[model samples]
Target: MTIAEVSEKFGISQDTLRYYERIGLIPRVNRNKSGIRDYTEEDCKWVEFIICMRNAGLPIEVLIEYVELFQQGDATIEARKELLIEQRKLLIARMEDMQKTLERLNYKIAVYEQVVVEKEKELKRSEN
Candidate 1:
């Protein structure tokens, strides 16, 4: 597929796709005879993986390192696994912190709701 097609299909900008290639976030895409990018199935898979990792909050440098390790062939398997495991641990910690913040916000909202209800009751009693 052409870069335009890939961009539309993946919901990513064309410039971003080019930037990913330039930054080595993804492997270089093969170009057609006319010198336009023509993404193969493997290229698309790389784009999908990169997008997923980025959405998960993985750092760009970490992802670049992972891609480099991947290019180094089978010897980096254990290293790749360790990198992912470490990232997973960090993600879990961030999730836990976000959960605490959510709980605190919920509690504050509930308190305000209860206060509003009590005020309504007081107003009703005064009217009576």
Candidate 2:
């Protein structure tokens, strides 16, 4: 697919796609004779993987390391697994923290709701 097509299809900006290529986050995309990017199926897979990892809060450096390991051939399989395991742990921890924050926000919102209800009751009582 063309770069524009990939950008639209994936909901990723063209600039971000270029940045991913420049930073080696995803393997270099093949260019057509005109030097425009032509994303192959494999290239699109890498883009999807990187985008998912990024959404999961994986660090750019970690992803870059993973890609480097991937490029090093079969010898780095165990190393890549270990890296992914470590990153998964970190993501779990972050999710736990986010859950706690969500609970706190819910609690605060409930408190505000109760206060409003109490105020409404007070107004009703005073008018009676």
Candidate 3:
């Protein structure tokens, strides 16, 4: 696959793909004689992993550390696990915060509805 194909498949922009490569977020994609990117299935899979981690709100620095540890092979398995565990905890906390915000929004919506009803009652009284 080429860069265009990867970008389309991942729903990411080509510039983002180039940026990822430049930032060492993903491994450098191979290029053909023409110096155009020639992405392989393995390379695409790595990009998919990066996208998933990013969607999960994983920080880029942490991801870079993960990638570094990953390149070290089996010796870094424990370290990688620790990184994932820490990230998971952070995600959980964020989720909790979002839940509280949702609850507050719901409460405020209910208050608005109550005010609307009160205004409607006032209008009905004025009509009488």
Candidate 4:
């Protein structure tokens, strides 16, 4: 498929796709005789994997390293696994921090809601 088609299918910008190729985030996409990108199934899969990792908050450097290892073939399998494991640990820690922040915000909002209700009651009592 064309770069435009891949961009539309993945909801990514064309520039971003080009950037990924340039940065080696995904393997180089093959070009047709006219010098336009023609993404194969494997290329699309790489794009999908890279996007998923990015969405999951994996660092660009980590992904680039991962791809480098991947391109190195089976000898780098264990190294790649370790890299992914480390990244997963980091993602989990970030999620835990976010959860704590969410809980704190919820608690603060509930307190404010209760205070509003009490103030409304107090106002009603004064009017009586």
Report, for every candidate in turn, its global Cα lDDT versus the true structure. Answer: 0.97, 0.96, 0.94, 0.96
For candidate 3, the lDDT comes to 0.94
Judged by lDDT relative to the true structure, which candidate is superior, 2 or 3? 2
How many clashes in candidate 3? 0
Model 1 per-residue lDDT tens digits across residues 38-108: 99999999999999999989999999999999999999999999999999999999999999999999999
Decide which is better by TM-score, 3 or 4. 4
Off by over 4 Å in 3: none
Instruction: Give the top-scoring candidate (lDDT).
Output: 1
Clashes of each: 0, 0, 0, 0
Q: Candidate 4 residues 5-93, lDDT tens each?
A: 99999999999999999999998998999999999999999999999999998989999999999999999999999998898899999
Candidate closer to the true structure by TM-score (higher is better), 2 or 3 = 2
Per TM-score, the best of the predicted structures is: 2
Better of 1 and 3 by TM-score: 1
| Candidate 4 C-alpha RMSD relative to the actual structure | 1.2
Give the runs in model 4 whose Cα sits over 4 Å from its true position. none
Q: What residue pairs are clashing in model 2? A: none
Model 4 earns a TM-score of: 0.93
